[model samples]
Target chain A: MESFVDVFLFGKCYSVPDNLTIMGAMEYAGYQLVRGCGCRNGFCGACATIYRIRGDRELKVCLACQTKVENNMYVATLPFFPLIKEGFELEKVSPDVSVMMQLYPEIYACVGCNACTKSCTQGLNVMQYIAYAQRGDFAKCAEESFDCVMCGVCSSRTSGCRRSGTESSRICSPRSCRSPWRN
Target chain B: MYTGEILESMKKVEAARDANLALEPRRMTAEEKDALLSAYHPDYKESEFETLKIGVSRGDKVPHELAALLQGKPRIGAGDADLTKIDYDTDVLIIGGGGAGSSAAIEADNNGARCMIVTKLRIGDANTMMAEGGIQAADKPNDSPAVHYLDAFGGGHFAAKPELLYKLVNEAPDAIQWLNRLGVEFDKAPDGTMITTHGGGTSRKRMHAARDYTGAEIMRTLRDEVLNRGIPVIDYTAAVELILDENGRCAGAVLMNMETRELRVARAKTVILATGGAGRLHYQGFPTSNHYGATADGLILGYRAGAKLLYADTLQYHPTGAAYPDQIYGALVTEKVRSLGAKLVNAKGEVFMHPLETRDVSAASIIRECGDRGNGVKTPDGVGVWLDTPMIERIGGEGTILSRIPAMHRMFAKYGIDIRVEPILVYPTLHYQNGGLDITPDGMTAVENLYAAGEVVGGIHGRNRLMGNSLLDVIVFGRNAGRCASEKAKSVEPGALTLSHIDAFLKERGDAGIEGDTVSPKLLPVYTHGNPDVPKKPF
Candidate 1:
């Protein structure tokens, strides 16, 4: 018989296959996926989940696709958060600090709490990049977040990494017209 | 951005190119191709390439010793005899997540079957994503299914299966409609007619594309719909074995989690194998453009489940894949580049074979020219012909390279080679498998409940597939398999497990006293430049 580990999933206790990842355990618990799952490999950061024990206060965050679910652990998947995005003509925009603020003003909402950096699936220093964005240093922020797959995990874990898809590449990609500088 | 005035002028250039295409690029006659093939000793039987198990073969009855490598793994007991657990149960289980698998899943779901997709990678990460060429479909009045059929038939050297070929060309317009309905944005001209272009062997402009990322556009659209429909998918799970019922009917499959290495079973009424090609097999000592998971897993699974394989020895080597510049090695340079009027010039600045010849003949001509006649330019990477990309910009004008072939332009640009100004060195690279599990026109395998679609099945394009027919092949057969399997699933009850079929297969092989390689297709020799056993180009 396969060993089963007890874990609290969405507030219900269920026994699932031992040594299975969080995504595997959630499926084994009959949770049908609509979102919160992207690459299934760690390449996409969509499945970032948060968890904690019943009595312990250590709030833990890990990618559900890679992290194993522990016994008696309570977990919840972070839904894609709503983020502000100001659309404009790419060729017309000057792509400066004023444009960045006008496009995603939510970048200014970062607290000193480093939760976004702490919970990053790609090991990106979200707090540092948020500071860079806050300081109007688009190049530094783009370099720090070059590998973002826009899984939206960083945004779900923080107030500052608000917008995804466009924001991640807009601040970074050389192909984007708003890139800090051409490579 | 196109206007009728611009199109009228573009037509003039196209008209001029059409006039000179014959004289400028000398077309190789059939006799000429046969001579080249003869010089290269064209059979893939490995007598010339050392003991490497690479090369092409026309087909012969395999002696028992060499047949064991193609057999499936030993089957597990029964569907439920072990009384352990059924990890998943669905009305229709789709095994791959490429364009075919996604399209099939959508159609099956539409037919009211509970469908599940199991893939070896992320649902969207497939060779379908890597594909940049347009899809072939007879959507224009000037082009018809008959014309497409004739082109495909001639391209395959008349070796393609008639029924499969007929269905492919006939159902193509409807397939394009299905894709459009599913939100695939095909490229269009000023008059809103789908942009049509010729591939290697086509007679007319019939390929409907989306910029250069036609496959990506269609694949991502289908993937989004699959998500929208809430169709369950077990990503990163490879279908390692097919489960058979007591009567030798396929009941379901055994899946292995690629990352966790955990074994899981699925009891499904119908199994659709949409896993793509075996280009990674590195047949004939060529690098491949297939995805990482294109290792014939579905072939091994179906062959093990009592399915008869077809044309098992043939492989498709696309004519112009990146052979120089180490980083982008083996990437397919879309045939659209040729359709746009580029030329293949040798190191001596002499024009080689006609740029528009079918892949097999064209690839063979390059091999004979470079490896045999020593006319190919010696580069740090390899000897090859240069595909004059700048000629495309010259013919199509300023933004043509950026708009029509952006993915390619962007890829080369990243490597510091501006294709608009310079040429790209290319050679033949393994592209597709012309042989796979044999299936009927309706996508039914020899096994009662087993089905197949996409590049996984064989005999659709006999010896060679035309450039754009692959995208057409996937959707046409994908929808057929999905709809048929769903209708069949609606009527059939849950099947009983059969362990006897396994005993029967092993007994048959044993009674025949089969010898030779019993290794998995994954165990086949792959040739990278660093590998010591990499076969040298056989002249």
Candidate 2:
């Protein structure tokens, strides 16, 4: 009889048969997995994850796709973040910014086309920056949004506003002197 | 050499320089400074000084015969042959360090032959590393070598040589076992048996992979093994020509060190050319997954040495490469997605592929769809349809899919389209070549004492290749060539090769001069050849 292994993923634990790969284990646990583009060969550092055993005490950093599942092994997928500090400078480059926008536009999209600029409690250039960003001019957008106070008046009155009610309640009023753009 | 005309031309250049210097001290505004810089920049030509320099250079070196030669007139005695002496001696010399060469080196070492691998780049940088699918082998109980051979024959339209294909399929299992022993962590089933997956033009699940990075893993393992065996890998070394002995046998080869640009010679009992293929020649087919060094250098070398070159035109175009950001548009997307249940669909979400169609046919369908606009698909240049995204998501979740294929997800994400929610534009790119130096079943080329394997040799693939068979071919024929060459080398008499032949050859080819340019009229045809059908498109 083959030994079985238990692995946890997505807040759930499941038993995987012996000799099954981590990718196979993920499938057994009802998660679909695939190799990403760009040197899907571990060289690209994509698909990297955090893995640990529940009770046994060995810390190992391994590629999820490359590692085989062990009995009672616990694996967690970690978000990709480059280790080099200078690598963040890529954010300032236009091509890099454009690529990031293409990959995760949710982080950059501010679709509430601002009638909010007119209602700004601090009179910031919120509308202009949003317009620049919509046109894919991130530099211009960053420049224009340098002074937004994030008051709720724009959220309540703007027709394009689609943010959640909880988010609107946390908006910084002018009296607070704190910018909501800090995040 | 003492012509008055040369002296006058030199004087004219000196006068022009004087005039330019005399005008440099005038008070100039920013506009004037920009103009001056632009005019005198190193790239600037047609300036007075530049014109004079060109005139002087032309006047001093104008050969009347050269002008006629440039106008399609052949010069007499231009075919001067020079024999060069070989320097290094090895039992086996393997040209190209891709899958085939590395495998051959390992096998040769195992057979007790001193081997040296000469590659155009680092061993793993060839198109083999870009291969996304798995290596095909008859590993499952239901699968057999005969079935694998039949699939290959059918896929190539029976154009493949039956004998060579039989050897490939029969020997493939041992090759896979060798890879496993070398630490290639292939995808496994619950029983620990290697997981076999499907690919284009295959009836059975015969493909073994590590997710989509099958090639990279194989190359990495092979490279590690080659290094561990202490095989000398000469990277950045390109073989320029094969050196034939007095009896028309392949003695060795002349190589050009690409970095230092110096020439070196190797004399071996056997020569193996595993130099991969040529994909850059195609104009408008598909983006190439080939390395920059894959320029058919081995083919040219073999052809010049009188070895038969076959199937020079049958290039394989892989479907589904990214279409944006032109630098990487032609990179290969592993075909495992289809095996994992992803389907090819057009813009209207209709299944465009028969799911099991051959790769060539599938690529053609996608190209036609993009041309006709029948599907919402359009190649960036009306060349092919976009790969559907919803299908990928429907088969696998966005996060799950992204996690498995982080490279593809990140690439698409860079284009501002989440693959989970939006379709990705794709087109076929030149992925592989099915034809090259003609070789025997044992990987020996037509030239005596010469051998080849993997993508460098033709006939195994014929008109088309079966999915997963490429890696199999590399190991199977690679080992065969190595073992055969080692046996042959043991019996061959050691002969003397003098340096005089190489010196004469270099002189006839025009030695690299200190100041004078070395030009070759024979290179024009080779450099000008490219796929005429591909249209010029801006990145």
Candidate 3:
């Protein structure tokens, strides 16, 4: 016997089978996704999503393909957010804070707010890494944020989140930096 | 949680860890590997494949599922599309936006060609991003391109085309250096020396990585370079069919908007098909470690465009996919684990075959243990052997697994399985498509003005690919295809565009009485729960 749960996807309610991931339940309810889905594993951050439980006031961000459904869960896929992206030639750029600032000056605008840190789906110390970037300790910043999937949840939460990622990427010398997209 | 008996077996594995650490199994010779592959490898099983009835590959044996798609009808007819309306015009049109496509676009743009990238998903959303092991490059003082060529040549069983193999090996070091110059942050030692490690079938430790996220690092770097160069990338748009000129030269492709179902026309002087592989087909009913878009889109598209495929019958099954804890089944457990000193142990908690053999040999050994010997640990979903991951920490010391393979550790941790303290069950999962469109050393396919790179181009790896070479293959051949295609684009002009090749392909299938409900270039695989029509395990 199969149990069912009510999931509100983009404000439309559907009774989906229990034990299905949010992505799976959407498909089970017959939504052929054209967007907000990538690797179908957790690697690609295409399926970044925000949801809330029936009684909880707090919103949670997660990879929809990896998170299981809860009864009365409210789900909405995160759309693409247009952010400031600068372009530069890698051969000419130096691994210094000055180059990072020249490309993205917005890193100085970080207010030390923990909003980006709390909003990270990958549980990275987003604010701390950003501070490291601000202090020109980019090697430390690169190590702390190596596992970031660049889901942009952090950027959605704060003003300085976008450039912080690109800052760490700029400082990714022969050090251990694995930015999902340094751009 | 593991079953009680499985837990009991794990205890045995833990107890025997010290012995397993010192265990040294003899490596198989070429002839021995050949005998083992013939007797155990799934590719050698004749009943699993059938001869094609239509198209250029007619009478050639291939998997039945693929044969159906190969014989599938064209999505658009010759007269259906408006060839007069070209939305995007470029000198080089690169299909797919994975590593290969990105590499192709970068080099094409570098060669002074107006290039555009079109992908089914986001630019960096690809198997390349999901590749967890490392990239191969022979740059160490002791390792030369000659040695690298011999290692790769012998690894592929000497069946690899010498020209393509030579190009791949010779240019690998340069490719690595290019990526480094492009801001790809490779792992380095304390003295600023690049760190290299061993991969399966490698004589020297030439594998360079950005920790466990080698592919992600490389992919993100290339994608950033593409964006930095202002290369036009059409996201969420897939190339449904390749368009050819009236003179039978490759012109461009018909692009489909995955969301709006709108058709877009792209006209170009040359087309580079880097559309990647077919693991999403779930060949042999096995779970795959591919991205959602790895549905063999390039194979069918190239086939319809009058290109010849090589070794379509062969596929690479990665030996260490997670097989237990049903939720994460079929996810990749990278070969880096084996390279890091993990051992494959059977039900009796004993070390099995040498874990560092080629993927095919390693997968066959696992299958033999699970099926023929009945030594696999059984659960409701399937059977799998244990890969002693804790041995990595035992060998490399504490914090090794966490730092070296963070993504892997996080994946298991999500399922409440701490791999640092225990072993994980593994089974062979469909990993790579070893063969595709046959190409020259420079990535020119059978069709003029059509080039291929990455997994779509076959014959570079012969029947099997070694670890790290795939990442190298994308950059090496992708740059070659891009640079050569752009140079060729300078002199040639596209004639009147038409879908006559697809029309001819469909007509051939119709004449052969080969009918299918499916369409070519299957953009996305259908995934639904509890489809009794599809077998659970074909093997």
Q: Which runs of model 3 end up more than 4 angstroms from their true locations?
A: A1-4, A15-17, A100-102, A158-183, B29-32, B531-539
Choose 1 or 3, whichever is better by lDDT: 3
lDDT of 1 by residue, A1-183 (tens): 556778888889987766567877776665544457543434334576878877886677666865766788898887454533233433355646776576555556544566567666555677787677667777676555543434455555332333434334223211121232211
Candidate 3 collision pairs:
none
Taking the true A–B contacts (Cα pairs closer than 8 Å), what share appears in each candidate?
0.00, 0.01, 0.45
The better-scoring model by DockQ among 1 and 2 is 1
On the 0 to 100 scale, the lDDT of residue A47 in model 2 is 42
TM-score for all models, in order of appearance: 0.71, 0.59, 0.94
CAPRI tier of model 3 = acceptable
Model 1 chain A, TM-score vs. native? 0.77
lDDT of 3 by residue, A35-56 (tens): 8888877777788788999889
Best by DockQ: 3
Candidate 2 lDDT score relative to the true structure: 0.57
Each candidate's B-chain TM-score, in sequence, is: 0.88, 0.76, 0.97
DockQ of each: 0.03, 0.02, 0.38
Sorted by DockQ (best first), the order is 3, 1, 2
For candidate 2, the clash count comes to 27
